[model samples]
Target: MRPKLQIACDHNDLAAALEDIKNVGDVVDIIEAGTILMLQEGRQVVECFRALYPEKIIVADTKCADAGTTVARNCATAGADYMTCICSATIPTMKAANAEIDEIQVELYGDWTYEQAQQWLDAGISQAIYHQSRDALLAGETWGEKDLTKVKKLVEMGFRVSVTGGLNTETLALFEGVDVYTFIAGRAITKAENPKQAAMDFQAEIKRIWG
Candidate 1:
């Protein structure tokens, strides 16, 4: 399938986050109420974004490792179409969270393996996220061959996969021949001088490669 773009609004200030969205919202496929933003502004931010762009997919990146049901309910009530749960969370928590929302994305990172993904897929979950480790990115890392292998393997297992962590224009080319259900861009677009143009360019690149 063709890849989709999810622009992460990582700011703590709602005004700033909305401003970022205002600049690029029209051109993107999904809006992420980033973990920081959600922590500061709460689910109301999700509600706010939903009120503004009812047509776009809104994701509350709660990254819930526990209390999944509560987190999922709040996100759903505030209008998030998808919520991410850490794969390490208990099966009951994963199930409860999935029960409360339209979709659940099991976030896979940090020693998370294909065997773990098999368990998740077997549990009836259909989506998972592949994030480059934050510490690795801070150390100047980028997606590599191992990342590609995971995306390919996960798709083969019937799970839609999203990739994130330090993804930018230069690195995006790295995934050219792969099947990515979604490509998440945070600082790459949000911090750009002209976010709208940045987003338009991102959309263009995805279409250019996939079409």
Candidate 2:
């Protein structure tokens, strides 16, 4: 299957996010209400997007470390298809969130072992997001062999993996044969001069590689 294109609306305000979504929302398969935007605008932002694009897959990047069930419930109540929880959270917490929502993504940041990932699978959580992080990007880091190794391992372990952080059309070719469930681009799409065309370019690249 073709890798799903996700636009991470990591803006500080609603208007800016909406402006980009207005152009590119129709093209992208998933719309992520980024952590910063959710932090500033709350779950209402998720609801707002849900109202605007009811058919789109809406992800609330809650990055919840705790209060699993509650956060998951809130995100679901707001019409999000998925919510994110940190991989460092306890299995019970992960399971709790998983129970409340249709799907919960284990955000693979900080220190997490494959054993822990296995545990997540055991707990009925299948989605894993391999993030490079904003800090890592600002530090001049880029995706390399190390990142692909981990992503490949997770896919081998029976987890559907989604990759994010500073991704672009050029970088999408790197994972040509890998089964990445989704490719998440935040600033690359939202910050573009022509968001819709940028999204189309991404889709065209995805089709060229995945098809």
Candidate 3:
């Protein structure tokens, strides 16, 4: 399957996020209601987006920690096809969330190890995210061969992984060895002068590489 392209609208303003949707919604496969947006506007934003584009797959990036079941339920009820929780969230929480929804995504961020990723997979969680820190990006460190190796290892272990953080055309090449299930592009698409064009370009590149 071609890797999915998720467009992250991490803005605080609803109008700006809607504008972004209007621009790129047609090309992007997933619409991510980023953590910041969910924190600011709650389920209303997800509902609005669902109302606007009933056919689009909406991902609510809740980043849930403790109340994973409730968060997942709310997002799913609000028409989110997928919702996210922190990988470090308790196993009970992960299990509870999974029981409530069919397509909840758990992100492994901030010190989660590969062992933990395996545990999540063993617990029946299918989707995961790996991100480079902003500090790492600002320090001019590239996502090295080691990162791709990690992704390959995770894929070999039967987990679908999404690569995120500071993704752009130049950095995207580093993903060659990584069987990335999805590429999460936030500021690269939302902050572009032409958001729609940027989304189209990213989608085109992904099709070229993964299709």
lDDT of each: 0.88, 0.94, 0.83
lDDT of 3 by residue, 12-64 (tens): 97888998889888888888998888888888889988898898899998888
Better of 2 and 3 by TM-score: 2
Tell me the TM-score of each prediction against the true structure.
0.96, 0.99, 0.94
Q: What is the Å distance of residue 21 in model 2 from its true position?
A: 0.7
RMSD vs true structure, all candidates:
1.1, 0.7, 1.5
Candidate 1 ranges beyond 4 A from true positions: none
lDDT of 1 by residue, 68-133 (tens): 899999999999999999878988888889999999999886777778777777777899999986
List the candidate numbers ranked by TM-score, top first.
Answer: 2, 1, 3
Who wins the TM-score comparison?
Answer: 2
* Candidate 2 minimal-lDDT segment of 10 residues: 186-195
Off by over 4 Å in 2: none
Clash tally for model 3: 0
Which structure among the candidates has the greatest lDDT? Answer: 2
